[model samples]
Target: MVFWVFGYGSLVWNPGFEYDEKVIGFIKDYRRVFDLACIDHRGTPEDPARTCTLEHIEGAVCWGAAYCVRGRPEKERAAMQYLERRECEYDQKTLVDFFKETDPLRPALSGVIVFTSTPDKVSNKYYLGPAPLEEMAWQIATAVGPCGNNRDYLFSLEKAMFDIGHEDDLVIELANEVRKVLGTMAKEKKLVGSPLKPLKSQTQPQIPTVQLHLLPPEAVAMDL
Candidate 1:
C-alpha cells in the first residue's frame, strides 16, 4: 500500500519524511496562506493562548508536496511518530485534515498535525513581513532562497501560482501592494542581495525589519 500526504505549510519544502514522488497536489475551495499563528516554535514559548489559527485568506494558494511510502504496520506507526515529531509544535487536528484532503489516486492520508487558531482570533496572518502591497507580492514571489524558513510554503504557492498564471485578490491586496517600495532598500549584509556600491543609506538595515517569525496573535494581544 502507498501513503500520500497533501502538504500545505513548511512541509512543502522541509518535509522530513522519506517518500517518493513529490508532486504539486491541489484541493478545491482550499488554498494555502501564511495565516496560522504560532507561539512555541516561531514565537516565544512563554506565552499563553499559543494556539494557531487557519483563518480565511483571500485569493491565496498554497503548494504542497505528496509522497508515496512503503512499509508495514510498525513502519506506519513510525511514520506517524515522525510527523508528530516535526509538527507536534503545531498541533494538527482532524478538522484541518479535512481541509487538506485531495483525491484517492493522489490520496494523502495521515495529515500531519498543526496548531489551529483560537477560532475567535482573526484568520489572516499578520503582515509582519512587508509594509506595502507591491513589496509583499515580491517577497511572496521571490521569497525562496538556498535555505531558509521563508522559502518553503509561501514560495511554493507564489511560484506555482505564477507558473499556472493564477493571480487572485489576496495576491493583489492594498496592504501587500504598498510593500514594493520598502523592499528595494536592501535588507542588510545581503540576506538576498549585496550592499549598494555608492554606500547609499549608510545606516545599517535592521534584522527584525526583514525576517519574519509567525506568532499567535494572542502573544501581542492586550492584557484585558
Candidate 2:
C-alpha cells in the first residue's frame, strides 16, 4: 500500500525521508498556528521555541506538501520511523483529505497523515496553546537549542512557503514581528541576557465561520 504524509511546518522545507512523489495541496478547515513548544530540536527546556500546529477553524484552508511513499514496505516503515522521532513533540497523528491547488473542490488523496499536538495543555506537556502575537514573537526571537535558534525556524518556514507560491500571512506577520523584537534587542545591546519567562496564555482570535464544501463518501473515507 502507498503511504502518504502531509507536511505544514519545517517538514515542508526539510523532509528528512525519501518519497516517491511530492504534491502541493491543501487541507480544509484547518489553519496553521505557532502554538506548539519545542524543547529538543530548536530550544532548551528552560526556553522552548514556538512551532506551528494545526488549529481547526471553519472555512480555513492550510496549504502544504503531501509526500507519497511506495514500492516497498521496508522503505515506508523507515520513513514513518524517521518522522516519528523527528516529530516527537506532536502528540497526535491526524488523517485529512488533500486537495490539489488546481481542483480545490475535490480531494486528490484521502487519509493523508498530519502530525499535531493535543489541545489540552495539561494533557500535552508541549502544548503552548495560544498567546498574544507579541509574546509569541518574543519567545520565538530569543529561544535556542541544539539544532539552531528558533527565529531561523520561523524564517525558514516563511521562505519555504513563499518559494512554494503560497505565502502564509500569519507566518509572515509573526516573522516580521520577531525581526522587530530582534532589532530592538540589538539597538539596546541586549542580545545576551537571562532567559525571559513564558508569557501568560491569551485567547486566540475567533475564526469567522464559513460553509465548507462537502466531500464525497470515498474522499472522506479513512480506510486506505
> Which candidate achieves the best lDDT against the true structure?
2
lDDT against true structure, model 2: 0.93
User: What are the runs in model 1 whose C-alpha is more than 4 Å off?
Assistant: 39-63, 95-118, 121-157, 160-224
lDDT of 2 by residue, 1-224 (tens): 79899999998999989999999989999999999999998898999999999999999999999999998889999999999999999989999999998899999999999998888889999999899999999999999999999999999999999999999999999999999999998977764665566555534566889998987889879655
In model 1, what is the error at residue 185, expressed in angstroms?
Answer: 5.8
Best by TM-score: 2
Predictions: Cα RMSD each: 22.8, 30.5
Tell me the TM-score of each prediction against the true structure: 0.45, 0.84
Q: Report the Cα lDDT for residue 3, model 1.
A: 58
Candidate 2: list runs displaced more than 4 Å: 190-224
Q: What's the lDDT for residue 144 in model 1?
A: 30
What are the lDDT figures for the candidates, one per model?
Answer: 0.44, 0.93
How well does candidate 1 match the true structure in TM-score terms?
0.45
